[model samples]
Target chain A: MIDIHNLDIDMGRARVVSNLTARFETGRLHAIIGPNGAGKTSLLKAVCGLLPSATGAIRLDGHDLTALSLRERARLMAYLPQERAIAWDLKAIEVVALGCADLSGEDSLKHAQQQLEVMGLSDKAETSVFSLSGGQRARVLLARLLATEAKIYCLDEPLTALDPAWQRRVLEVFKSRAAQGRTIIVSLHDIGLAAQFADDLWVLDHGRLVANGEPEAALSDEVLRQVFNITGTFAEGRNLRIDPQALPEHGA
Target chain B: MRVKSLSLAGGLLISGLVLMGALLIVGDVPLSGADYIEAITHPQSLNGEIVWGIRLPRNLCAWGVGAMLGVAGAVMQGLLRNPLAEPGILGVSSGAGLGASVAIVLGVGLVPFAVEASALLVSLMMSAVLMAFVARFPDRQALILLGVGISSLCGALMALVFNLSPSPVTTTEILGWLMGSVENRSWQDAALCVAGLAVAVGLVPRLRAGLRLLTLGEETAQSMGVNIRHVTLIGVITASVLAGLSVAVAGIIGFVGLAAPHFVRALGLRDPYGVIWPSGLAGGVMVLMADGLIRVMPASGDIRLGVLTSLIGAPLFALIAYKSAKSWA
Candidate 1:
């Protein structure tokens, strides 16, 4: 379980996230959904220990993460940024192997290869990441995250450029990881996708946590209108479809 | 793949040794293969003194400078995640040149060891300044742009020093040093290059893992347990030392740092760790070959080592630019 209390993140020029308090239960997929500049990414960054919060205690299993060394904290949590930053044309397997920064043994290679197989990227293991398609690149980076095998994962918009097929595939992978008792917190933009796959949703509006509960209750029309200002009907189907009629234009 | 790269590094090492041997035999005082063998076997011969005093030191200077630049280039590229992140491009080399010019103008170079000491000091200072500037923006385009600005500033300062020279002789001496020559370099110069090489070799194993993580970018590497600031500082200082030491020894030899790692990568070494040693070996060979080629050529005036390197390096740099233009865009 991950718990964040009074987490406020300042981004040099302005505060991106403020007074955010939440507890993310273990063994579930929790999605952070918000409008643009809602501080979804900032909250995740603070919790993952990437961004230092002005006032907050991020505890993992009741242990304060700030008290732990970076190495120890890395063992407990992993973060995947939104950017697809494969700067070099390293082989796919090599890219995955980078996740084991603390481990230096023959076992690291085996673990990386196994994670690649889990992501269904085993065949392209010898290929360079620069040549992979956008969706495939996303999966390769996901494989890097899985190779960490950390207890908690903070993924920011992991499905940004992925297609529908890959979206379902990655969601299934996340579900399987959650089933194995790993806590996964992902910041997502697609409300319908979050509704279908996320076990819980934390809705944010301008850096404030407006709703936090099961996806079905938290993603209702009233919350959507208030948080996103979009009046919509939440229709459940093969894909959770949000049929928007109009925007309630009080203010964004 | 590791085996293949190791073998390539071995091949490069052997080629460098062969070039060094050939260079020893074919200088102004030409000696036969058998005569050269006799000079090696008979240490008391006059040829032995010539070989040890002149030929060996000069060759070692070239080899060591090449290795330093190559390794430093690889580290800078890996740290900054920019293919064009050589010391020359980032203003470190020009900063060293400025230091050397200061030493010359002040007649401090007449004092043994002061030239390289001052050059290394100024080079590191300039590198720290650029790194501090880079930290403010910490983006790809911003880094290259800042580097260009710093390099131009240093180049202009060097020109100003030249213009302010009190005598034509001083101007000529400064110009000759700027041309980058290893000719008539003594053992003391070679020792400085060797020292830089030893430091780089010592740091490579530790830097390998950090550089590998760094290639993924600062935020991601920090998440993976890498202290990005520590790695960046070490990497930049080491690269500056390497470039400064080389400049102190061989003048401003360009493009070896930029080209050596690219050559290694093109030869199928993708891992940053895998690229380090091979790139060093390739760099040594490049400078050795360039120096040897100049010695062998029957030119009217002595061809400058820096000129030949830039002659080859400039075109190769253009090719790299053309190929990687899309990525920059």
Candidate 2:
């Protein structure tokens, strides 16, 4: 669904994302994973066309992403940044409705409302998003992305501040959406969640793409040791277990 | 909700007509309701030229200018994402005031519209330059500091112009404009203000989406498909023009711009369309009512619009700000 080629995002003098090439096919959940300072978020932003590529091309469904207008891109793909603090006192449902702000009519409103309910936010429909707990607010925003009818959902750390049960629920929602032929690319901090939910993974370190493939291959001990400077085993049992083989990623 | 809309529309129309009528009926030789009607029908039958020709046009001009100031103030607060923002804060008004002051001292009274337009244009350019400067900084404090610096610079230049003028009449006239009055405006001035107001009203709806996103701060707005630079420019230009036209007509009316929109917002006028129109209406009503008070009450020299507004608007503003602070947080 998306192709990123030789992407290098330069912020000031430093390159946030080094030359990177990747394809995100339709109908699967792909996770971008790495330690702190990784260019995972930058890669997601570049792919979603939020940032101007310092030196590369991002294509969505064979269309040059940079050439597409905002409305066109917004219609085909949805983006949820890591931070979701709203300044206005908009209702949870109204916040979701903003995803389809360009569109007006009963059908769009109904669809948005349904998406809010799917995120288990129907009871909080009229509640101000600011009044809701952090996890609930994230769910409200997720519903907004779901309401877009966009082919791809680019989420940068959708799991932050979510409780463990809510985290599982959100990951399941992404899995189900991918099963229904939507592309989900998420920047995740939780390695276990990435392995549990992602059909494919891209591991980044120091602005460079270190590994990309099946979750098992990308999260392998060798790649973990090299990219994260820590050795860990990915044990496939009881909902994707993680064996903490390293005392610490760095010297204690 | 529909009731609120209807009541709002009804209130605006009623208040506009009543205030216009009151303006017509009051003067040194007060006209009765019948006399006021006759004066409109038969212009030559007026008691004094100042009553029909001067006072009427001036009243209309004041009404229009007041509305424009209020709308500009509301939009600036929204655009800058700060409740305390006003046209005066960004030096747009001061810049425009300087341009008008230059024209006044240089004797360009014939095409008041042209003068107003030039003022608006200059102010808009200054705001654009300031916005460009502001873009270099990540912090809001930087933008405010830059604006304050520009305002002070303009204020100094304005003071110099008043000081250097050959006659006291120039200084007096500039002070009158700065104090803001609806005393003796001509029909041509009324036409100018109306034209400016029409342009602003037409522009507001097209920029509503961008304005909505802007409240989220620039980065967030950009993430939501808003082109920040274009929207900010549109808002700044539109606001500058409105405020410039207001200053050109009325001198330096204060507090209407600062207090009127916020008053309406504190009354739960959050939607852009309602905020624009009601703020305008509130501006008109507030200025006219204050003008009426200045005319009728107390044995005194001409009480300036600016003084009365800061007197009334400042307290009302403080109250509203206190109430809304927690909501914004």
Winning model by DockQ:
1
What lDDT does model 2 reach?
A: 0.76
The residue pairs found clashing in candidate 1 are none
Q: What ranges in model 2 sit over 4 Å off? A: A237-245, A248-252, B1-7, B48-51, B104-146, B162-172, B215-224, B272-274, B320-329
DockQ of 2: 0.35
Which candidate leads in TM-score?
A: 1
Best by lDDT: 1
Global lDDT of model 1: 0.83
Local distance difference test, each candidate: 0.83, 0.76
The TM-score of candidate 2 is 0.89
lDDT string for model 1 (A131-249, tens) is 89888888888999998989888899999778888887888899889999999999999887888889899999888998989877887768877787776555655245555557777
Instruction: Give the per-residue lDDT of model 1 (tens digit) for B32-53.
Output: 7676777789866877767877
Over A73-113, each residue of candidate 2 has an lDDT whose tens digit, in order, gives: 77788888777766556667666776776677566567788
Instruction: List TM-score per model, in order.
Output: 0.93, 0.89
